[model samples]
Target: MVFEVIGPIFLLLALGYLSVRLNLLNKEQVGTIGGFVIKIALPALFFQSLSSKDLHQIWYPGYFFVYTSVTFLLFGIAYWLMSTHFKNTMSQSAVLSLGAGMSNTGLIGTAVLSLLIGQKAMTYTSLVVIIESVLLIPTVLILVQLGMQQKANVAEIVKKTAFTLFKNPLFAGVMLGIIFAIFQIRLPHQISHVLLMLGQTASPLALFAIGGGIVGMSLKYVNAQSFYLVFSSNLVMPLLVYLGLRYFTDVSQEMLHAGTIIASLPMPTIFAILGQAYGLNEKTLTPLLMSTILGFIVSGTLISIWWA
Candidate 1:
């Protein structure tokens, strides 16, 4: 079952990588493709998935709270370890925390979990996307800004962060979906069909883009800090969520499995993009993401087996 789920995804990824290597797709074209996936297809998918489900069941506040708590905890710990112990600058530590704290829930996650667990699980996955978008990513950005010693006002930063979240297509999709679900507003069949078509493109294209994105990253960039971030993201973060659900809550086994798998996903591709934006180390972030994604083939497969 695990291979049945992961094999095709990676195959498409390999195809993308080969395409890039063979000069079939350049980096700029790949970036454009990835941008389309993130801005259009993914949002449509999230909207359709969330709107089709019962909002009552999809809105798992307890699960959201616990997952967010674990994410923030890992972020804090990663920042501390990188700053105090490794003697990295605050900005570097903040970037590392972003890698450790956020999972690839938008791309790899939605693809894998939707395959393994189905659309019902995707409803939960959309919620996970919301929590990460509206909370985790913004918080990390704030930390990064502060770490950089930028002379921006805190109040302005807070407002900008809130506005940025509001402008996020994924977040908007989830919010609008919830509204539609709550109000029982049904879209016309033609509209729904169009959304369904667009939404279906998200997973495959995203997986392929991820592979293409990783084509130029070299393994030589892997170091102690990158390894530590990978460990925190792939191992520690998921373990914390699993244990937290087991001991603290009576959530269903399905939810536990969903949460664990989502947490275990590799670092978000946005980590590299944001690193570039914030003048952080792309060498480290890129390789770390590549390693984590490759590592997830094993870790994620084992996780699916265990949960199954």
Candidate 2:
């Protein structure tokens, strides 16, 4: 059953990889596609996911608090440790922390959990997606901005952060989705059908962007330390989340497992996105690439075993 659900996603990503390798798409084009997903497709999907659920079925407030809190705690500790040895600049450290800490919740997360837990339990996972996209990613980006500049006041920072959050297409989508979810208003039948059709494009577009970005990247920059860094984020974070939550909380097994799955998943290409956006060195892309490739393999194996 798990394979049945995951197979299409695997094929979609594979197609994306092939498309890039064959020079069918360039990085800019891929990024544009990513923009489309973030702006149009993903938000539509978010709305659909949020609206489809019965609010009573989800422990939204509790899960949101717990998952977001734990995410920051684990990620903060990991970032501090990595910064000490790597000696990354504050902004670079912030970007790396975000890249390493944030999971690809949109691409792999929704698909994997939907298969493993079904639609009912999906709201829990959706909450994770919301936290990462709407909260964690933005907070980290703001920190990177402050860390890099080393000069912004709280008011300036808040002002800039608000602008970025509201102006960003992806974040905007999430906000719209939440608003609709809160109002308990469904899109009319025709609009709902349209959203469903458009929303379906998000996963493929996101995965393809990942692949396209991967095609031009080289592995030569990856070294022992970089590999270790990636491994620590990819492997250690998940284990920490899993073990920490397992013994600490009485949350449902599904939610517990959701934490582990997210923790275990690969870093998003957003690491590179923020890095490039802020003029951080492209060298960071090495670990980002390597970590993503390795993380995908590890996650697949781990989830397959867990599913079995």
What TM-score, over all chains together, does every model reach? Answer: 0.93, 0.86
Question: What lDDT score goes with residue 226 in model 2?
Answer: 66
Q: Give lDDT per model, in order.
A: 0.79, 0.69
Tens-digit lDDT string for candidate 2 (204-238):
67766766667777775666546765866678767
Worst lDDT run of 10 residues, candidate 2, spans: 53-62
Number of the top lDDT candidate: 1
> What are the runs in model 1 whose C-alpha is more than 4 Å off?
149-151
Q: Residue 233 lDDT in model 1?
A: 84
Candidate 1 C-alpha lDDT tens digits along 1-308:
76677688779889888889999999789888889988999889878877776668688777888898999899899889989987977877777687787788888888877777767766768777877888878887777667766686787778887898999898888888888899877777788789889988888898888888887776666667778888888888888888888778878888888888888888888777777776765645654666566457645675568744
The residue pairs in collision within model 2 are none
For candidate 1, give the lDDT of residue 6.
Answer: 69
